[model samples]
Target: MEVDHRIRVSDGDGETTAGQGGVVGVFFARCWLRLRSVLVGLWCWVAGFARKVGRIAREDPRRVAHSLKVGLALTLVSVFYYVTPLFKGFGVSTLWAVLTVVVVMEYTVGGTLSKGLNRAFATLVAGFIAVGAHQVANRCGAQGEPILLAIFVFLLASAATFSRFIPEIKARYDYGVTIFILTFSLVAVSSYRVEELIQLAHQRFSTIVIGVLTCLCTTIFVFPVWAGEDLHKLTAGNLDKLAQFLQGIGI
Candidate 1:
C-alpha cells in the first residue's frame, strides 16, 4: 500500500500544525475588502459631494464648508453602519430615513417636525397600500397585478386632484408622482404578504426616524446650515460677479 503525504490544512487561528498560508491569506483578503468598501464610500462623499459644496463655499467659505462637513460626516458615519458586520441593517434604515427627511426638508419645510411627518406619512401610505394589494392578490390568486394597476391609477388621479387644492402640489408635481410610484411599486416588488408588508413598513419608518434625528442633531450641534444659505451663497456670488462686470463696463 502506497501512503500519500499531502498534509491537510485548516483555518484555526494559526494553530494548524502544518501552517498552510492559504487560509491566512483568504482571511486577510476578506478583511481588506471590507475596509476598502468603507474607504470607497468616504471617497465618494468627499469627491462628489464635498466639491459641489466647495463651489458654494467660495462665497461664504467658512459657514458653507462647515455645514457641508457636518452633513457629510454624519452621512458617512451612517454609511459605515451598513458596511460593518453587526450594524448594517440599522444603518440602512437610518441612512434611508435621513436622506428622505433631507430631501423633503429642502423643498417643503425646514424643520425636524416637517421632515419626520412627511417620512412617516410616506411610510404609512406605502404600508397600507402594500397590505391592501397583498390581500386583493391573495384572494384573487392573481399576485396583485390588477390591484396594483388600479392603485396606481387612483394615486395618479389623487395627485392630480391635490394639484388643484395644494399649490405646493402643483409647484412640485413630481413629488406626489414619486410618492405614488413608490407606494404601489412596493406591492409588485414585495411577496404580497401582510406580515412582510408590515415589517417593511416598520423598517422604512424606523429608518426614517433615525435618519431625521441624525440630520437634525447634526444640523443643530455640529454645523447647522440651511438650504437658504446654499442658495444665498450661490446668488451672492453671481451678484458680485455681475457688479464687477458692470464696474468694468463703467456703468
Candidate 2:
C-alpha cells in the first residue's frame, strides 16, 4: 500500500514525496550556488590586492617607503569601500569606478582635489548617459536585437565623438574612456530595467563621489606619489649607467 503523503493544512496539501525531493534538491542547489559565488568573490578580491602589490613592487625603486605608503594609502581609502554603506550597494561598479579614478589621478593628475572633481564630474556624466539611454530604450520598447544594435551604434558613436573632442580635456582622454567603458558596461550588465537604471545612476554617482573623496583624502594625508618621479628617476638611472659604461670603456 502506498502512503498518503499529503498533509492538508488550512489552504491546501502541504508536502508529498515529490515536493520533498524537489525542495531538497533546490536547497542543495542554492547552497552550491551560494558557495560558488562566495568563492569567486573571494578569489577576485585576493587577485586584485595581489596585482596592486605586484605593480607597486615593480614600479617603486625606493621599494620600502613607497610600497608602504601605497599599501597604507590604499588600505585607508578602501576602508570606506568595504566598511561603508555608500559603496556597498553599487557592487562591482563602485570598485571599477573608484579604481579608475584612483589609478588615473595617481598617474596623471597628481591625485589632487582637482582630479577628484574631474572624476566626480566624469562619473556623473557617465551615469547620466547610461541612465538616460536606458530610459529612452525602455520607453521605445527596444529589447533583444534592437537593444544590441542600438548599443553597438552608441558605442561606435561615443568613441568617434569623444576621440574628436577629447583634445580639450584637461586630464586628457583617460577620464572620458573610463566613463565610456563604465557607462556601456554597466548598462549592458544591468539591462532593460528603466526604474532600476535610474536607481543605479543615483547610486553610481553617490559611490563615485565617495570614492573620489576617499582618494583625495588619501593623497592629501599620505605621501603623495607623482608620475614625474618616474621620469626623474629614469633619467638619473640612465645617466648613471651611461657614466659607468664610459668608465668601463676607458678601462
Candidate 3:
C-alpha cells in the first residue's frame, strides 16, 4: 500500500511539470510570431521608402533640387535677420519673415505669386479696417468703446467665416480672405495699445514682403519648376500611355 501511494504522488508531480512546460512553450511561440510580424512590417516600410527615394532620384530630380533651393532660401532669410542691424530691432518678430516665406512658397512660381499677393493684399485691407475701427471706437468714450468693439469683432468674424463658403471667393481669393480674417482679429483685438499698432503692422508687412520676394527670386532663378510645363508633360504622358494601351488591345 505504501509503495503504491508513493508511485501515485510521483506520477502527479510529473504531470504538473509537463503541463507547465507546455504552457511556457506556447507562450514563447506566440511571442516569436509577434516579434517576426513586427520585424517584417518594419522591413517593408524601409524598403518602400528606399524605393520611393530611388524613383524620385531617377524620375524627378528637379523636385529634389527645388526642395534644396527652398531650404537655401530659408537659410538665407534666417541669416539676414540674425546678421542685419536693421532687423535687430525687430527681435523675435523677425521670425515672421521666415514664416511668411514658408507659407507663400509653392512648388511653382505662379502658385507662389498668387498666394503671396493674396496674403499681402488681405493683410493691407485688414490693417486699414482695424485702424479705422479703432479710431471710431475711441470717440465713443471708455464706457461704450468695449461694447462697440465687441460687437464689431463679432460681426466681422461672422461675416468672414460665412464668406469662406462662397464658391467664387473660395476658388481664387480663399487664401486672401482667410488672411484678412486672421489679420483683422489680431489687429482689432490688440487695439487697446493703438499707439504701437501702426508700427507692428509696418513690421509685419515688411517681413511678409521680404519673404514673398525671396521665394519669388529663388523659385525663378534657381532651377525653376513651371506648373504649366508640368501639366503639359502629364497630359502628354497620359495620352501616350492611353494610345499604347489601345494598341495593345487591338483598338
Candidate 4:
C-alpha cells in the first residue's frame, strides 16, 4: 500500500513540472514571433525609404544637387548669424534671414530669382511707406495717431488686396503684393511702441537680401537647374509616351 502511494505522488509531481515547462515554452515562442514581426516591419520601412532615395538619384540627379545646395546655403546663412557681430543687434529677428531662405529657395533657378526679387522689392517699398506713415502719424499727436494709422492700414490693405487679383500682377507680382501687405502691417502696427522703425526695417531688408543673394548664387553657380529645361524635357517625354501608346494600339 505504501509503495503504491509513493509512486502515485511522484507521478503527480512529474506531470505538474511538465505542464509548467510547456506553458513557458509557448510564452517564449510568442514573444519571439512578436519581436520578429516588429523587426520585419522596421526593415521594410528602411528598404522602402532606400528605394525612394535610389530612384530620385537615378532619375533626377539635379534635384538631389539642388537639395544639397539649399542645405549648404541655409547652413552658411545660419553660421553668419552666430559668427558675425553685425547680426547680434537683430536679437530674435535674426531668424528672419533663415525664414527668408526657406521661403525664397526654389527647385528651379528662375523661380527662386523671381520670388526673391519680389520679396526684396516689396519689403523695400513697404518699409519706406511704413516709415513715412509712422512719421506723419507722430506729428498728429498721441490721441489722433492711432486713428490715423488705423485708417492708413485699412486703405493700403484694401488696395493691396484688390491689386493682387489683377491678371498680369497675379501671374508674377502676387507674392510681392502679399509681402508688401505683411511688411506694411508689421511695421505700422509696431510703430506705436516707439521702436526705431527705420532701424528695424533696415535690418529686415538686409537679412532678406542676404538670404536672397545666397540662394541665387548657390543655385546659379552649382549645376543650375532651369525651369524651362525641366518643362521641355517633361513635354518631350509625354509626347514620346503618347506616340508609343498610339502605335501599340495600331491607331
Candidate 5:
C-alpha cells in the first residue's frame, strides 16, 4: 500500500505543482483558485435580480405592485431622454430628472410627498441663496472667493445642523434641511470655478421639479396609501383597546 505524500518543495525549487517555489507559494496559489471559483459563480446572484420590473413582476402581489409602479414612473421620466423635443428642451440635464425619480419615489403617499416637497422647496431656497452668496463671493476677487465661500458654507451648514435639534423641525423638514445644506454647499463651491453657475442651477432645479411632480403623481394617484388615514386608524384602534380595558374593569 502506498501513502499519498506531498512532494518536497524547496524555496528555490521550480518543480512545485503551482509553478511557484515553497509552502507560501502553494498556499497563495490555492487561495487564488478559490477566488476564481467565487467570481465565476457570481452570475447566480445577478440572475436572480434580473426579473423584469413590470406588472406582476414577482409572486408577492404587494411587491409586484410596487415594482410596476416604480417601473412606470421610471418609464414616464425616461421620456425626457427618448422624445426629441423634450430632450432638446432639457439637454443632458434631463438625466437629473431620471435620477430624481429613482431617488424620490417611495412606498407611501406621505413618504413620497414629504421627500418630494422637501427636495423641491430646499432646492428653490438653496438655489436663490447660493446665487446671492456667489455674487458676494465674486466681489471678494479670485484670491478671496474660495475663502469667502468656505466661510459661508461653514456658517450656514452649522446653523442648519443646529436647527435640526429643534423638535418641530426634526419631526418635519429634517430631510429638507439636510438637502438645503447639501445644495447650498455644492452650488456655493462650484460657483467659484464654474462660469455658468446660474444656467446650471436653473437646469438642475427644473429637472428636480419634474422629478418631484412625477413622484407625487405616481404615489398619490396610482395606488394611494393616505398617511392621514393610517394615523386615524391607529388612533381609533388605540381608543377601542382603551374602551375594552374599561369594560373589563366595570365587569
Candidate 6:
C-alpha cells in the first residue's frame, strides 16, 4: 500500500511539472509571434515609405529639386544660429528667421514672393499701430493700461475679422490681414508687460525679414519654379489636344 501511494505522488508531481512547462512554452511562443509581427510591420513601413519617395522623384524630378532648394535655404538660415559674429545682438530672436523660413517657403517662386512681402508689410504696419496703441494706453496710467490694451485687441480683432468677409479683401489681402491682426494682438497685449516693446518688436521683425529674404533668394537663384509658367503650358497643351480631337471628329 505504501509503495502504491509513493508511485501516485510521483506521477502527480510529473504531471504538474509538465503542465507548467507547456504553459511557459505557449507564453514564449506568443511573445515571439508578437515580436515578429512588430518587426515585420516596421520593415513594411520603411519599404513603403521608400517606394513612395522614389515614385515621387520619378514622377516629377523637379519636386526633388525644389525639396533640395528648401533644405539649402534652411541650412543657410540656420547659419545665423551657428555663427556668433553674424548673429550677434540678435540672441534668441534668431529663431524667428528659422520659423519664417519654415512657414514662408512655398513650392513656387511667385507664392514665396507674395507671402514674404505680405509678412513684412503686415509686421511693419502692425508694429507701428501697436506702438501707437501702447502710447495711448500708457496715458491712462498703470491701472488702465491692461483695460485699454484689451479693448484695443477686441476692437482691432473684430475689425480684422469683419474685413475678411469683404470679397475684394478676401481675395487679395486675406493672408496679410490675418497676419496683421496676429502681430497687432501680440505687440499690443505684451506692451504693458515689456518695458522696451519697440526693441522687442524690432528684433522679431528683423529676424522674420531675414528668414523671408533667405527663402526668396534660395527659391529664385536655385532652379526657380513658376506656377504661372506651368499653368500656361498646361492650358496650351489642353487646347492643342482639343483641336486635334475636333479635327479627327470632322468638327
Q: Pick the candidate with the highest lDDT.
A: 6
Q: Is candidate 2 or candidate 6 better by TM-score?
A: 6
- Point out the higher-scoring one by TM-score: 1 or 4: 4
Error of 6 at 5 (Å): 18
Candidates 1 and 6 compared by lDDT, better number: 6
**TM-scores, one per candidate:** 0.49, 0.50, 0.78, 0.80, 0.69, 0.85
Per-residue lDDT tens digits of candidate 4, residues 3-73?
A: 32221123544632335556677799999999999999999999999999999899978878988998988
**Global lDDT scores for all candidate models:** 0.59, 0.62, 0.83, 0.88, 0.85, 0.90
| Candidate 5 clash figure, as a count | 0
Q: Summing lDDT over every window of 10 consecutive residues in candidate 4, give the lowest-scoring window.
A: 1-10
**Which residue runs of candidate 1 sit more than 4 Å off their true CA positions?**
1-58, 66-80, 83-116, 143-168, 171-177, 193-195, 226-251
lDDT of 6: 0.90
Please say which candidate is ahead in lDDT: 4 or 5: 4
Residue range 6-49, candidate 5, lDDT tens digits: 56554575555433345677689999999988987886666655
lDDT of 1 by residue, 143-231 (tens): 55566656654765576455656767545444544554565565445644335556666666676666656555555555455667768
Task: For residue 218, give model 2's deviation from the true position in Å.
Answer: 1.6
Off by over 4 Å in 4: 1-32, 88-93, 238-251
Judging by TM-score, tell me the better candidate of 1 and 6: 6
How displaced is residue 183 in candidate 2, in Å? 2.0
lDDT of 3 by residue, 1-251 (tens): 45322211236446323345566777999999999999999999999999999998889888888789789889878975778685776655578779988888888889988999999899889988987788888899988777777777889989988998999999999999988988888888788656687888777777777788889899999988899998999999999999999999999
Cα TM-score of candidate 1: 0.49
- Residue 123 accuracy (lDDT) in model 4: 94
On the 0 to 100 scale, the lDDT of residue 61 in model 4 is: 89
Query: How far off is residue 213 in model 1, in Å?
Result: 1.6
RMSD of each: 14.3, 16.7, 5.1, 5.5, 8.8, 4.9
Give the top-scoring candidate (TM-score). 6
Q: State the displacement of the C-alpha of residue 98, model 5, in Å, after optimal TM-score superposition.
A: 2.4
**Could you tally the backbone clashes for each prediction?**
3, 0, 0, 0, 0, 0
